[model samples]
Target: MRLKVLTCLVAVAALYAPQASAGSKIRVETRTYDVTGASGIELIQNINRKGPKRGFMAHAIALTAYSASWDLVMLRRNGSCRVRQANGTMDLVFTFPRVVSPMSPALKRRWSRFMAGTHAHEATHGRLARDMMRAAERSAVGLETTDDPSCSKARREAGRRIEAVSAQYEAKQKAFDVTEHRGGGHVEHLVLALIKP
Candidate 1:
């Protein structure tokens, strides 16, 4: 997945303290497809039926697709200090396949356990995104410009800081995924558990 960057600049007549904000916002969205199967093995096959035979593609077996973006709002008025408010949004999308509702008790129990593991795995991605956003926001909120008439330099530096923080977080995400997807890792364990019957 690719990261989309959208920055919005706004100047308002207000002043904010030169300190990090306490709160940040996070949003999550989930989208699912349909898969039909009667048994655990069948379910796995159905989930991966349409998966690509290529590299680094998230398929419906159990996938988490996420992206984080930020909106930088700067406030400046005549004879007033320039203030910045950074709002970061992390969107996490979990794509799965729908299974049959009515199934045997034993099958249902296994399915439930598998789903729990998948959900937990995806939740980690969301959590990481949220943490990165908060760090970016904190960095942006602390920026200050001494020259009131020319705040361009300050703005540019703040933008760079935010970008750098995001880049670092992205690296962390890649590393985490590598470990989780390695042989006998969490993802593999989840799959094995699902088809253990």
Candidate 2:
């Protein structure tokens, strides 16, 4: 069985522009891990200790991940094989930090701002992921080729298109991050404000 898989590892990432097909479904899930911090500095440290790990050494304040898998059916006609249909599903997971400790009024205000900004940032990633899945479905449905009768090449081409969409989306995500995380950028301002004592 040829299963088309697109996976992403990001600090909440990617996007594409394509109309969604009827055969595709996307499932979204959200989870939070609680951290103990009564102050902004403490909260940052708590997040560092409890937040989602992006790589081997750093933890992200929030993160989103997506994976797409699809089953493609191909039909052999006269002298060629073509994709009959592609039924696909995209699964997304979002992880964020939750503070469990009691906070003073000032701390609560700061935390509220931090959480709001973080949610806004992560939401962009979620939107992009959904778009990427739709684009992949568009690339796979009704794909046809005459070069290979066994339909392997057509399947490979579909996979290629799917990966290309993913790569494009990934680049978009990176560009978005660069803008948000640059010095004096939105994320930097948010982080500095949150951590200000």
Best-fitting candidate, scored by TM-score: 2
TM-score of candidate 2 against the unseen true structure? 0.85
lDDT of 2 by residue, 9-107 (tens): 111001222333447678888989998877798989988887887778878888887777776666666557666666677887888888888988988
What is the Å distance of residue 1 in model 2 from its true position? 33
Per-model TM-score, in order, reads 0.77, 0.85
Writing each residue's lDDT as its tens digit, candidate 1 over 35-82 gives: 666788887887777532224554546555556555555555553334
Best lDDT among the predictions, by candidate number: 2
RMSD (Å) of each candidate, 1 decimal: 4.1, 7.7
**Scored by CA lDDT, what does every candidate get?**
0.66, 0.74
Q: State model 2's lDDT.
A: 0.74
Residue 102's lDDT in candidate 1: 62
How many backbone clashes does every candidate have? 0, 0
Off by over 4 Å in 1: 1-23, 50-60, 75-83, 146-150
